[model samples]
Target chain A: MVMIPPYVPEAFLTMYLPAIYAGLIVGFIGTMAIAMKREEIHILILTDLVGLAMIFIVSAVGTDLAEALILPGLVVELAETLAISEILITREMRKIEQDPRRNLSKSSSLFPQPFSLDMEIMTTAPNFIALVLIGYGIFLTGFTGGAVAGGGIVLYALSKKARGLPVLILDGIAGVSGIAWCLWIIGFLLFFVAPQYWLLSLFLAACGLLLKVASKVGLIGLLMREDIDKE
Target chain B: MEIILIIAIALMVIGAFGIIFLKKPLDKVIMFSILDAGFVLVVVAFKYLDVAMFAALVDPLSTLVFILAIVKINEIRKNKVSGELND
Candidate 1:
């Protein structure tokens, strides 16, 4: 026979959880109230706050596993925002009767110059920053590593374009990317088919992921540059 | 509450209010980044370094997308309004 306590708090309950909950409530209510009166563009910005609220809720769980879960949710949030933004732009472009070229020329200076830096610093900063990020990313490995490395590559690509430097595309980059995909797949298969070779599989998967992610992100950067050049 | 937690909460609350109430879209974007920065701080407070790393790397890309959308929309609106005036 066991004597049960009259009241027992939940294991996961914490003081901070309440604060997070309050924040989420505030975020949601604020977004809803303001979104009702705003245009589509304004509403789109509000949606990101909703995503942040979701992150707060998830992180309130306060566990290593729960924290890991936030990464995927963040990625999904980014992807959704991107797709919606693109769709909105396309719809507006089709609905409006205007010459896009003229507008593009007028708005080419999308980012304002906030500084009067020398050209020497501008040319070297991107390279240094990208190298540091990529190196740190490689050391980290896994999803975080991929993200860091991908960001570095994107910055590098964009900086190249900003300086009017030609971004060289290697002929075999695509082929290497394809092969890396196979490596990742094979590594996954081995995890299930041959659990004993876990170490080997892990190495193969990490290497493949690094190369695959870098190549794909690099290609995206290149596409963005081309689009900007077209404009 | 811990100092870090207090700072995080402050950043987030202020950011939320600013994003909702700010008159300019650029200000809203700026507040969004501030909110994101607070979220990263929370992650750091929780000792989830890996998650924090990913979030820090990703936040700017999302902001860039927002900026791009804002710029494009504004340009489109300007052209449409001017065309209407001409007509």
Candidate 2:
């Protein structure tokens, strides 16, 4: 068996690493300085800039391992943004004596007028585009696949909302996604305890992960529909 | 260094500055998208196609989240101001 050559991490670090670092420094300082003078909302937005800088620095390593490292970073950044945004909204709602949950459940049209869903392409396109995305996501399998698949579902759901579609089966979709999550965990456990069952583990992990991601993302679409629904 | 890499770096730096200096939430989000595009291109330049694909797909969702947050915040501010005026 031919041995795969080990990747030298230093190879890329020596060339143009300084440029990447400069970007990172600028990002960090810029956000910090601006954040000092801004409100919570602006500061929250600025944090995302810091994340971009971190990505630039991390990707400068230019190796497979480094590439893999970037996934966790991205996930953490996304989670941070989501959690912070939720907290900001909830706190603000409560400050005004509004029942946050009630507001979320009842509000329609997050923006002003002309935000209407009357586009001609909304009727013609999203289906094909979402289909292609979901197909590509399946082909990519793993975390990247999940992102692509989730994106497709989100797009499809948004378009459905634009067309005035009702979201009826959200709980069912969430339940199935939970089951897929369990399967994914079992698949990982199997990899460690039953190495001989590699094929079974691989199948479970890949399929379960893909399904879990797609359905969870689809739920985002449904939830957005619920939020934006006027009825 | 390749011309593409240079351009990508420039884009990111410009975006970073724009986000910091631009006071409006909408403008910041727009600049953030520019920064995201540059980051994705840099990943592509480094030949990590998988990571780049993931970045491209997820960036929009993050931007959407930001926009939603900004809108909600603005709405809350409006309600507070109007309520104060009514009182």
Candidate 1 clash pair list? none
The superposed Cα distance between candidate 1 and the true structure at residue A65, in angstroms, equals 1.9
lDDT of 2 at B8: 99
Against the correct fold, how does model 2 do in TM-score? 0.67
lDDT of 1: 0.73
lDDT by residue (B11-48, candidate 1, tens digit) is 99999999999999989999999999999999999999
TM-score of chain B of 1: 0.96
Model 1 misses residue A123 by how many Å?
1.8
Best by lDDT: 2
Candidate 1 off by > 4 Å: A1-16, A30-38, A93-121, A162-174, A223-231, B1-87
Q: How do the predictions measure up, each by TM-score?
A: 0.62, 0.67
Q: Which RMSD does model 2 reach against the true structure?
A: 6.7
| Distance from true location, Cα of B35 in model 1, Å | 9.8
What local lDDT score does residue A96 receive in model 1, on the 0 to 100 scale? 45
Candidate 2: which stretches are off by over 4 Å? A1-6, A9-13, A98-115, A161-168, A228-231, B1-87
